[model samples]
Target: MDPSTLFAVAPTFPMDDVRIRDRSRETMLRSPLTWLPLLGAGAMGFALDAGVAGFVLLLGATVALVSRYWKKRRPAVDAASLRELIGESNAAQDQELKRIIGSLESKGLPQYSLCLGRFLFLKQKIEKDVHRGQHFAVFAQEVEKGVDGICAEVCREITGIRAREERLGEILTSRQPTQLERLESARRESHAAILHAYTSLYQVHAEILGLGSDPTERETVEDPGELPGQRLQEILGGLRDEADMIARTHARIRRTIEECPPAVEAPRPEVVC
Candidate 1:
């Protein structure tokens, strides 16, 4: 059996002092080896005076059991507190994304491009933080939730950009009669490319939601075959490649939008007819 398959749930996050203490307390409770020395000492006490020693052993055992139960409760409380903190952090991150995206949208083209570049930088930072935190099983769900929310918001924004571009195209079709004839052909190709990009973004969002490992679409084999060595390398390199590819694509689309000229807002015609 695979080592990973053996564990029901993977671990998550950096273990803190509180977690260390709680783990140590639980270790003592679960292992009978912990009481071997105690039992041996109690036996020695018994040899000295059977009745008095028996009573002492009984008292000690009872104390140990009671102490174990008390220590157990504190760990539970610690776990609950950590979960609440994770929940709060996730909420804060959602608000942060909203603020950043809104500010970017409010800016002029050059400024918006710079802001988007910064957003991508910050987004990469958050993703790394979440991955590091994922090593501790206690916080994995929270990390996943935060990451998914970020990805979904990005996809929604991409869809919005596509819709905006379509509206701009329609206005151009009606207003710039002469220019439209020349540009309309090129516009169709550009629209198709943008739609394809939007589709990819939507798929990435779905994969994240499903907790699926990210995979890149490698070059299709002409003969419908893959070299064994290449296949192995792909399996090994998939996760990092998928993440990098996704980030690059998103960054490119953002930069394109930033560089695009603002649509010429057509003046409303006066009632002449």
Candidate 2:
């Protein structure tokens, strides 16, 4: 392996809206530190025949219950499971991005390859941000549902594309006009499908990053869409390592997809503009 061979970073999607913090707040509200004393206070008031005080305590308890009901935050996860899944998701996305990069390189579209790399870096930065106590949920639930399934679909779609390309390869000995048109049509459709896959991939990244705020109202934070030309060239050059790692890494990712459990398909995102 090359010294700079890609390694795993924690894959995180922007799931800031998943209510992890809400659940934490609710948990603390329900903990013994708050409710247990309230219960004790209520009991003591009743024991002393302090009817009005007991009613007040009961009212406080009712408020607490009502607060919990109103929040109704969900997708709660314990700390351990949360951490484990985060690590797993990080690995899955890392591998999948590698595969995508390799496929893009093969298609002679270095700019798109670099675009995806920058997006992956943005995702890595999110994980780093959360780790540094920024918008973090020590007990946050998984963000962006169906992430694994969407990644798996990307893998499956590329696999089909590769198979079709090979079939086309076997029949192209003739220079006949009809054969050339058929091949040209297949190539066009294949590129379109690849573009669609990339569009969905970018959407997944955007949702995880929570870039939903109005750009006109405020200066948006860093964007991967407008990656600088020189920087993109640098990224593409970086992908070409001494060890020829792309084929090996892509193969490993493909084998992983085949060996893993069946992926549940989610509704595909529309092609981005």
| Candidate 1 global lDDT | 0.45
lDDT of 2 by residue, 78-163 (tens): 44334555666676777767867776677665765675566456455544443333233421233222233333333444444454
- Whole-model lDDT per candidate: 0.45, 0.47
- For candidate 1, the TM-score is 0.31
Clashing pairs in 2: 11-90, 14-208
RMSD per candidate (Å) reads 14.5, 17.0
Best-fitting candidate, scored by TM-score: 2
Per-residue lDDT over 171-240 for candidate 1, one digit per residue giving the tens place of the 0 to 100 score = 5745545444434433444444434433443343333332323223333331236532333233223422
Tell me the spans in candidate 1 whose CA falls farther than 4 Å from its real position. 1-59, 62-233
